[model samples]
Target chain A: MPELKTKLKEYRAIFDMKQGELAELVGVRRETIIRLEKGQYVPSLKLAMDIAAVFGTTVEELFSFE
Target chain B: MKKKNNYRNFHIITIIVVTVVMLLYFIGNIFPDNKWLTPVIIFVYLSSTTKLIGPYEKKDELTKINLGRANGITLITVIAALFVISLIGSNSDNKDIFASEVYIFTALAAILMRSLLFIVFDRTPESLGGDE
Candidate 1:
């Protein structure tokens, strides 16, 4: 199944955030940001919600399937 | 369901095979020349495989599946490696067993396979056999 990930770069651009800053915001390892951007892992529901909340968006808006 | 303890079978068969293998080695006077290592290789592989995988099988479900997968991968990798070595050695009159890829392959495969199995098993305090 193709998993559409959050446009992390876009989110970071809105927040004026660097990878390290975003990782800190999300309370995850910096490497996790790298993998998330690459679509290597589907973030857990809790993590998705957390990331979406950080960006002031719903998890549904942040993630989608093509 | 009563968890089966087939550990006894594992122990008995491995011990018997080891003893027989050792006896055969002693009887044959295995030396530097004209001494095929197939029997010895099989003996060590079987015994180690049993010892490493058996206890986990008795204890956990995931452990069994992981070990089987690791073993399957290792067996495939080893066969591939052996075939490669044979291919390379086909032209050479003198193949140095000491520098053979099989040794490195076996060591890497066994260590990774067992470590993956152990990680998958994810030992608990109870599994550690602590004082009850």
Candidate 2:
């Protein structure tokens, strides 16, 4: 299976954001943010876009398949 | 997150309560009458289905995915168990294995499996990867 590597944690850190805050902004559960950061989950396009938008980045820049 | 946790807790509590009630009924110590067994069994089945199919707008995509996976696994497990029980009933002289009590037991087991599996899926990581 393709692994979905993410820079979600780094982005959150840079933004000084909490997982719960990011989740709220993206309209998801905090656990979902944790999973994405751990690369344990692959977000949908809409979620990816939302998260990227929150961090002022593009989805391609936030996530990559390995 | 709090809302999701509450929803999860509600499901776990409901399943546990129903399972305990069904077990007590099966033991025949608390309730000697079988009049309420059918209604209780039906309630369990309906509640389980509702939990699986009800509105999940409060849940995220990952949670929704996990829920689907859990329900799928529970359905297969229950079907396999019933098949085995039916086989046993057909080949053995003890046809009482196909009794209403057994159905109730199966329903309880299915819901319990679904709830546990959902928790497991929700907590476990999905695949091998790391934050970059």
Candidate 3:
């Protein structure tokens, strides 16, 4: 199975958004964001879009499949 | 913040109460003379409330999905266990135990499994909402 590599931490830092802040924006728990950034869990389409939108980037820019 | 504290407090209370009930069941079985204990156990089972274990309306999608998976696993386990239990009960000469008791035990096991899985996979309440 291909794994998704996220640049979430970098983009989030660039946007000055804490994990909790981003999670709230995406309507999910902070732990979900943590798991996503750690590549331990995958997000749904809606969640991926929500997260990307929060960082003002496209999902392709935020995450790469490897 | 207070709500989160209350939720944690509720969970602690639930664990303590469930532990006591299980201990009573164990002791009652070991020392059969405790007729009074049987009634107590029945009362505890009958009056049991699932305030801490009931489904929540506010769980996030990830948490909900994890919970669903946990329930599916628990259900499969219960079905497999009941098949084995039925076989054993039929083979054993002891007929003292009723089918209802077996069903109750199965239900309790399922609930316990679900609760354990939920606690293991779930994050702190603080992570679910507004930041501190």
Candidate 4:
């Protein structure tokens, strides 16, 4: 599978949210968010949607196929 | 943080309990008169690993994944040990090839099976809906 580059950190910073808070909003552990930010883990479609919703953007805007 | 600490404590306690049970199981093997002890030990070992216990039964997806990985690793370790035993059996003219150890493999495989099922079913839509 192609790697997904996430703009999670950028959006998170724009929203001034902590990793744990974002994780809580997205219904996942903080480590999941941390790994996602580091590009070490891929989010499922539902999780991706949840995260994108938290940042008030679409999944395509938050993540890029690379 | 508090929840994480509790999980750590639970794991520590579980390790101690499992260690004690394993030690007692081996000790029971040396005493043929106490045949009941071994079965009880095996029961506890199987139940704990299979997540029959409350804390483990309530594990999250990440914890379930870790448990599955642990089961896979432990199954590999058990298989390696069995191979070594078989080699010893060959060298020592024991044609049985450590037949008794098959019980251990069966137990380990059962745990691995349970872990695999947990990993698979935990991600299902039903389980997610049930969580809510």
Candidate 5:
């Protein structure tokens, strides 16, 4: 099953947040953020929700199944 | 999010604590400084290493899969290690009581299985995880 990822800069640009800022808000390491952007680590449901909450969006809007 | 963060933080803390305690143990052993402190240091070392599950793995049952793959791997490795140890010791009449393998097969198996479990079964239910 392929999990659709957040677009490279969509959430970040929406919040005017840097990668490090997003990582800190989501309670993951900056390296995790880097890897996640490069399609390495798939964010967990909790992390997905947290990120969506940060940008005032829903999890469904942030991620999709491909 | 914070829960996951604490898991990573706890792992770092454990590594630091174990490293310091082990260093102290070696220093105590070599220097022969305090007879009172050596046993205490050894106890700390054992306690820290035995705490493999930590708080996160304990919560996620799949990571605690000693009943399946981990246990099988551990059992086979231990049997093999014991065989090798016995073979080596039996070669001579005088048995070396303190002989050991630092990275014994059992230890290797445990680490590998633990890491595999952590990566693949990290959040999945045990019903859908591991090898028996």
Candidate 6:
């Protein structure tokens, strides 16, 4: 099975953003952001788009299936 | 965040209230005569109190998904438990546990299980043990 890998933590670091701040920006719980960073949760298209937008990147840039 | 806190607090309060009421009923301190009345009162109280909490709490996508998962698991577990309890009750000559009590216990257990599972899912990161 292909796993969803994310560059969420790297992107957050580049933006100097905390998990809570990113979650607030993307309208999700901090835990959701944490899970995304760890590749434990597969986000919906809208949430993926929202997070990617927050980092000023495309979803394909932030997330990949491996 | 305030809305989220309120939603969580509301569920915690409901669990505590139900547990106490059920305990009192089981101990023969309240509703000793009318067994069905206890569940009816609990159901009415829960429904009425839910309206008081308002419907304004907007859950995020992850929270909503976790809740759905938790509810599904809780339902399955409760049904399985009830089946096992009935099977044992039918096999044994012990008549200590009444059907109404079993129903009340099952409802309480289901509520507790769903709430606890939601809390766990909401708070715990799934990859906590993984290499960071």
Q: Which candidate is the best by TM-score?
A: 2
Model 3: fraction of the reference interface contacts it also forms: 0.21
The TM-score-based order of candidates, best leading, equals 2, 3, 6, 4, 5, 1
Candidate 1's displacement at residue A66, Å, is 0.6
Q: What TM-score, over all chains together, does every model reach?
A: 0.37, 0.79, 0.73, 0.55, 0.44, 0.71
Query: Can you list the residue pairs that collide in candidate 6?
Result: none
Worst 10 residues of 2 chain A by lDDT: A29-38
* Docking category of candidate 5: incorrect
Model 6 residue runs over 4 Å out of place are B1-10, B30-57, B89-98, B125-132
Candidate 6, residue A65: Cα displacement in angstroms equals 2.7
Every model's DockQ, to 2 decimals?
0.02, 0.36, 0.25, 0.11, 0.04, 0.39
Model 2 chain B: ten consecutive residues of lowest lDDT? B123-132
Reproduced native contacts, each prediction: 0.00, 0.33, 0.21, 0.00, 0.00, 0.25
Tens digits of per-residue lDDT for model 3, B24-99: 6667667777768646754654444334344322467877877787788888999899888877888888765445
Which 10-residue window in model 6 chain B sums to the lowest lDDT? B123-132
Model 6 Cα shift for residue A12 (angstroms) = 2.2
- Per-residue lDDT of model 1, residues A1-66, tens digit only: 887666876777777877667655666644455556656546778778888888899988877766
Which 10 successive residues of model 1 chain B have the least lDDT summed? Answer: B123-132
Q: Which candidate has the highest lDDT of all?
A: 2
Candidate 6 local lDDT, residue B81: 92
Give the C-alpha miss distance for residue B124 in model 3, angstroms: 9.3
Query: Which candidate achieves the best DockQ against the true structure?
Result: 6
lDDT of 6 by residue, B13-95 (tens): 66677776667667775455776766776786676557655553457888888889889999999889988888888888986
